[model samples]
Target chain A: MGLESIPVVTQSASDGLTGNAAAVLREIAARLESLAKEGQSGIIDLGAMPLSPADKAWLADKLGQGEVEINLELDGPSHVRETRYAGVWWLLHHNPQGAVTGEFIEITRIPELVLAHPADIISGSESLNFLIDDLC
Target chain B: MREQEGRLVASLAQQGISRRTFMKYCATLASMMALPPSAGIAMAEAMASSRRPSVIWLPFQECTGCTESITRSHSPTLEGLIFDAISLDYQETLMAAAGHQAEEALEKAIEDNKGKFVLIIDGSVATGLDGAYSCIAGRSNLELLKKVAPHAAAIVAMGSCAAYGGIPKANPNPTAAVSVSDIIKDKPIVNIPGCPPIPVVMTGVLAHFLTFGSLPELDKLGRPKAFYGETIHDRCYRRPFYDQGKFAKTFDDDGARNGWCLFELGCKGPITYNACATVKWNGGTSWPVESGHGCLGCSEPDFWDGGGFYKALSMPANPLKLAAGAAVAGAAAGVAISFANRAKKGAAKAAHETTTLADLEK
Candidate 1:
């Protein structure tokens, strides 16, 4: 007997804009301008806002995807993707169980979490030296 | 369990939690609390270097639902990590000690961290019959609270029962139960009120105390303004539907199936101040309103006595009897009454008075 395939349900894009999606877009634009002028980065926490699924979908549609997509495995899995706008990045952090813990829109050249820490770099260098000594 | 005597960062590292993960957790908490993004770094640094503050959890006349909610927090979760960072010296439900050993643990915790530990109370204080209604280890809850409250740095009333005398203090109030603040006037008390409060709210309060060495800014009800500043209605997703005047008249009606507002179904979201709509519950899962149920106003004082659960807020306890021809007129009257009530609620929000026991009666 053949197994039945489960149907996937997706939310339809709302006919009318709801909530503060427009306000958030304006804020993102302002932040992007600030980033260019003063090199100051900004982050908007989507999780904290009272945004609906339609609002989020509208946001994603308006801020079209860009080329850069990066994934990091830290405490859990995190995805960072640049928006169509060069400096704006969308980040989603999840737990080990794959539930989203935080969602953010970071307006910067690169997200701070993506950078390798100084302590980690030093430890990595020390470990490489220890490996070299053992071989010698 | 007692926290390891060392910097929190080192202890966290020992448990295999990386510094980056800890920082991210702090950032998430900061975001949730509406603190500036930069505050996350400061919170992370302060908490990482600071000693884990000792917490002593006391249960009075509760059902242990608050304890259950907090413990159900997922393993290695941000809230769970904050809970881990604390030295839970004595918690009757979670602690291994029992009877004499439990009493000894409570005594030792108070002795070792006198005037420094956080006292978390999960239930109401029964004052009737000279507090005979509830007793622990041969001592009345009232007596135990009096003995322990003075020695703590701050008290956190963890649920509606401890905050506003919850169900036990509803009509009749047989036990004459009173809130923690009603009994202990000298100490600073923060009330995290709910039927069973959102677990992250508990840990958020702890994180704030750990980061700033003081309680978070509180509302008139001694609740953290960060979590209770806005009414649930202000942040509810169905608010747009409410604005459009679309309401679910009955539970399984077409409006409800279409996900319209629950205002007519007796939702107390308009007056209830809580973070359930935004911060959510059970690890960012669906909250009560999200699951197609109206809010019970569990976070507010005297919620249990706030008329019937199914009666609309605009309606009187005993609804008016109207003729068949006057049904539309009655609907219009209800709408008018609702508008007037909304204006009154707006004024009340503007004033934000401290709810007293007398107010609970009203």
Candidate 2:
């Protein structure tokens, strides 16, 4: 193809995340801080960390737009990714106790996204867990 | 120092650099030195009068690639500018003498400017087998380094070979190759690491030191932060491809020609810290990744032992993930296009109806 062959996404990138991601992250961070005060150690809960709303929105928009198939594949240790298309996000996560491990047990957000990110989980040592990635 | 610098300034003026241009060069140097803009005049004064500092260049376990890289630099014909800028009294590679005369010259330079001249060591020091892997004249590299480095003002480890031991210091190093920092402890040493460092960067550091009388602030790795601060990936033009999840899996694939991200093709750019993307090579033209090769992360410490250059760390998720994403976008675009078409026809029909009514009235 030629230079003009590429389709450009003219949308502004400055505002990818809405308040949802921040609110969720703040809730999670606050809960983690409280849990630490109560003596819970050894859980690096990166998942509890707030996802930048801008990033989420960017991911969401790209899914709503773009070529390239992306999917979250979280299996075994170090398996994590954040992405979706046609208005969806497949984020595989652990429960409050951090014992149960599986894929798709909890659907985090979608269809105008309503979420509650608890903060207690992040209080443990090595609690910060999630690494956001655009799936390819 | 000022008076010595003034003589050089007078020489430069005689060679056609105007006082204003000289000051401009000073201002640029000051900026590169991380000094305030006003420091330019001070730099100008320093350059005008500072006595030419003596320097010693030692070649060790190296391929001479460092010299080639530096010499290839266009701004300062690496040889011409380096010697002109400093009082280069002894260099193993460029000096005329060979045998005892050369050795004597080196001894004289070191003694003449003890604790005042800069010592630039160009390769790693091999410590295995009584340091027999590399030798200068009749002495081992280790012995030579210990003897000559004690009275140097500052040390500039000029290549990855000298800075991080390059390939020799990689895994299973039988020679026990070590960096300049490993050997020299007294004087603060600045490492300019690359397979061979950027010519501009090397000169920039030299100019910064000459102008300000001190080394530039360094990163945790002891490399000048100005050049190694941001990662090559961060400044790359293909960053959008990564964000969009468009990647080239194979070297000669369609995606590669289409200008997709090279992460899947073992691109270490994401983890590599260098000015390759921004500063580029060969006069800001293009680097390896730009010329269509994954980053080797040459500037990072211990890069040679990192992993297979062809293998990528899929630790980070590929930007595009789900198969349904493309389908979803295509479907949405189709719907949008159909809706737009419907609206256009609808307006056209309405206009036709209005025209018919006007015809009846006529």
Candidate 3:
């Protein structure tokens, strides 16, 4: 099948939560509570949670929106958005073919994926220095 | 003590690291250290005001792999820069001084920074043949460690060799290789055990000490609980597969390509503890399992002797003659018991009569 021909199914409210979404939301809530109490953060794999699109929307709506919103492009474009509830995060990873490959609800002060990788940052700085030297 | 060079904040600013970036680094370090969220801000404040701590690195009976893991492999990293910023009084590999000059430098640094410097040692201490197996400058590693350990405030045993006698101490051990904990009994020692530990772990431990002026909480093996408290399996991305009983039978199988659990392929993640799953390698790029290889459990003691790397941890037990006979006997007993109970119940029901209002009054 051609990549262009593949149907892109964007999740909407109509795609609502799977039956197990309640259990997952409960788990996420418990995780968030512990994070708030213990001062530690952890990742939650929504990919394995078996939630439907509606459930995802329910979670997204429940958490609301926070100040931080980071977008990453690696295997594909990943949306990492923080919720109004402090320290809660919603991460959606799409494959190169534009299909939702993985989804997670990370509960950490800062998600690992959002952080600037040390090696990449170093390389970037080095390249800029080289560019400046060339320009001079 | 070694004199302060400059405050970390000023140095970071000079390196073109903005306050925002520096705070982010501090926050990341705080999270990695398992400190409270607000502690990130506290750490930023502390580190900004504090001077770089003095460190003395000693290498013995090593392959320099640990050094490479921290310095070369993770070069240009903030942690690497933090390592560089420290007052590295002496390091055999990186230091320009050698021969008598090197020995003199080590002595002077120790004298100057007595009871204040952080003594970081890599490699194992060999006791066989009067510790002659490994020596530096005509002195055995054991003797040198004994001499230097007394004056230092804290000792960090970096790498599996230093923490628990790695490959050298495996099988019919000839060197009588012993960990740093084996010899130094008086001082506090932190074991950062791995074939080569994560670079950030090394820096995190240093940062913890710098921030609090004390060692972080340690596990039973004298390792920081923050990093070694949980098994890799618990934090693995493929844990759901393990729970679902889906495993990759072979490396190239469909299950393997689909990122199934590698339990059947001798994955020691269930037993091993480290930050590879979360922190990852090469600046959070990927780890061994992500690259399609089972964990070697290098961080665990005697990992080299933990059976074959490709062999499963355990296989389902086969039904033997004894087991079969036991099963049969158990089934027979259950049948006999149930039969007797049924007979008794049937007899009681047969003999029983329904009671009317008059019988109830009586």
Candidate 4:
């Protein structure tokens, strides 16, 4: 009697581009090594990069969400959410009219948009001193 | 034998799992244990006719998560039925007997089934401060284990705690907790290690024992190699994405939402080995990875101390400046090794003598 191996099918392969996805994952792994070892952070500008909707969605689902989330509404509306990767942040800068201006993936402890610039820090110091004088 | 001779078969029939289904389960177990297909029939026959083996479960410095994982896995199903069929002589958590009565029952069962019963232990054995760290029935876990180990035919160390001291044996282990193997040196011990090892794994080991009258082949760490042979990454669904150079930079980014891969998100699937990918938790529903969470690598030894759960296995915050130099050096080494191999081959070829028909005849 002829016999063949009974294949145990756990799941059907529905999503293609798995090979491409794996290559990108390896690059990310290397980047993660760099991020952890050298305290260096780089931004991947989605606006600048050409990625299909499917590829983008695939990346988002895999990354998951991180512990930190920062929301800004000073100028118009800006959203910053950290991905499951501790230092990876998703930054969305909105225009004053509430239109999306830029989208970026920032790899850092804190996104640049939310950080207080040197000029802003000096202005904040002056404002605080003025407030203290007014209170006195 | 006891009245439990046909009890398991009868209960299985009542459960409506069918002989075919029961046989299928046995076959699956056999395959999982890397046994021959014919062994499945043997397992079915053995389980159907043999009386249930007596099991005495002892919990020590633990969280009872192992018990929960086993009982909660596919409850009201065949696995549960098989678990129920086992003659559990004494268990402090599930048994109604308590205090001196429970202790007496444990003693009586050990006496009644000496050299035959299976002693299943969850949690670590505490030896610190005169074993005052964890005491039950006014006896330290170490004391109880020492007393009961000799009478047992085999000892099943369930969960990381019993197998490798688990979290209790993490850095600065306060209780001086040690694994079952640390204490019971003479008895044959099978370690099932996980934060709370996969439930089916526990049942699989039991089935192997009940069928073969002995434990399955074990790896160096005393764990059944069938389940822990491959890393989670090797069997992960998103492994394709990892190979494709696609990663999600942010949680809500397009890459993540599309479920590219979580290697960048500090997934421990690579170095950590377990059956989570294939045997999904909560009855083949979904595991931590499927649910969009990085594997905590709960099955590995000293998982708690492996590093931050969110940190990638061997990554740095910044790129190494000497990476290019290292690559050049690695290439030189590779070239040198290849030249050496070629030289050896050439030398062997030069020394070779051609075989002639006359020489062969001689």
The number of the candidate with the highest DockQ is: 1
The positional error of residue B247 in candidate 2, measured at the CA in angstroms, is: 1.5
Tell how far residue B336 is off in model 4, in angstroms. Answer: 43
Worst 10 residues of 2 chain A by lDDT: A111-120
Ten residues in a row with the worst lDDT in model 1 chain A? Answer: A3-12
State how far residue A109 of model 1 sits from its true place (Å): 4.2
Candidate 2 on B256-362: residue-level lDDT in tens? Answer: 77667888777888877777775567654568877778988788777776644665655332122323221132434434534654665678687774333212111
lDDT of 3 at B72: 61
lDDT of 3 at A57: 73
Worst 10 residues of 4 chain B by lDDT: B318-327
Evaluated on chain B only, candidate 4 has a TM-score of 0.84
lDDT of 1 by residue, B32-63 (tens): 78887767777877777678889999999999
TM-score of each: 0.81, 0.60, 0.68, 0.63
- Model 4 bad stretches (over 4 Å): A1-136, B1-5, B317-362
TM-score of chain A of 4: 0.73
Model 1 TM-score? 0.81
TM-score, chain B, each candidate: 0.85, 0.79, 0.84, 0.84
Taking every candidate in turn, the Cα RMSD to the unseen true structure, in Å, is: 10.0, 26.2, 17.2, 26.0
Clash number by candidate, in order:
0, 48, 6, 51
Give Cα distance to truth, residue B308, candidate 4, Å.
0.2
